[model samples]
Target: MLPSAIVSMTEFPLNSNGKIDRKALPAPEFTMERCDKVAYVAPQSPAHITTCEILASLLGVDKVGLDDNFFVLGGHSILAMKAIMAIKQAIGIDINIVNLFEAQSVRELCVLVDAELLRKQLEETEEFEEEGVF
Candidate 1:
């Protein structure tokens, strides 16, 4: 796991017994900051837009771009699971958690979801043909 922020201090606060005071350290602030490493790219497709919305809502951000990294947007494992569930509920498709970690972007995730949807459609078509329904 990566730290959200780093705190700089001149000296450590100590207790009466000479032990470092844990409570004296300032709490790390976890805020949503736009990723600077990559330029902002707006979502272009419906699937990309929906995936962006799910990630943005979960991370408490205003907008998510196509190339935004989920972890860099303050998303962790728990939020990743919620994202998976939200995508399944909203898109009617199941995605593995590992895929989210591997993809880490709205564009990548939408591609995975789209592939899964197409695979399901193909399976249904094959089943229908086998059953002589069409």
Candidate 2:
């Protein structure tokens, strides 16, 4: 999951001794757009369903929609890596971390997963053909 809100600090908070002060740091503000008009859209395929389930579980949400923004839902970089690993184990596809950052929604991630799966299948087929195993 990505950060929903980012706080920029001009200088590090320091204590009287000139040490970094954790307590003096300002709290980050997190704001997400809430819309009552937005309807929940179900997963369209097995991959989509799996992706949603993984995200929901990782993000500790009751349910995740295809259009839901991961960062807005409290996703962070560490959780993103965890989600990627879970996705790889569940779907047998390696998802690049950068790709995950770029595609922050379940729908977009599913598309990347599908494309990766297709590429893997093609590669396997090509290898098999070269070896005359099929």
Candidate 3:
């Protein structure tokens, strides 16, 4: 498993007995360092914006950008399930957890969601044609 945070120090804090002081260690700072790899891209479409909001809420972050990585944002398997469920509830489209693992970005997920929406629309249109509703 990847470490949640890493701290670099010149020397370890020691107790009177010369043992390392665990409590004296500084708290690990959690930063969005992973996001530095990619330029921050704002969400342009409604679907993208909504997806970012859901992820940000789930991850307890203030904001989520289109290119933000889910795992880097502290999402795990359990959280992945929650995210998929949340998306289904919010957008009315089911997303496979496997796709989340493969994509892991709001922009990529919106692409999948858009494709599923189009597919559902096509299915409804076909059913209407069959029933001569059009």
TM accuracy, model 1: 0.88
lDDT of 1 by residue, 7-104 (tens): 78888999889999998877876544546667779988777788899999998988888888899888999999999999999888899999999986
lDDT, candidate 3, equals: 0.85
Give lDDT tens digits, candidate 2, residues 1-134: 23455779899989999999989888986433442134678898898899899999998877788888776676778989999999999999999988888985768988998999899999999999999999
Of 1 and 2, the candidate ahead on lDDT is 1
Off by over 4 Å in 2: 1-37
Q: After superposition, which runs of candidate 3 have C-alpha atoms over 4 Å from their true positions?
A: 8-26
Q: After superposition, how far is residue 36 of candidate 1 from its true place, in Å?
A: 4.1
Instruction: Give the 10-residue window scoring lowest on summed lDDT in candidate 1.
Output: 29-38
lDDT of 3 by residue, 28-51 (tens): 976767657777788887777888
lDDT of 1 at 103: 89
- lDDT for position 49 in model 2: 91
Candidate 1 yields a Cα-based lDDT of 0.86
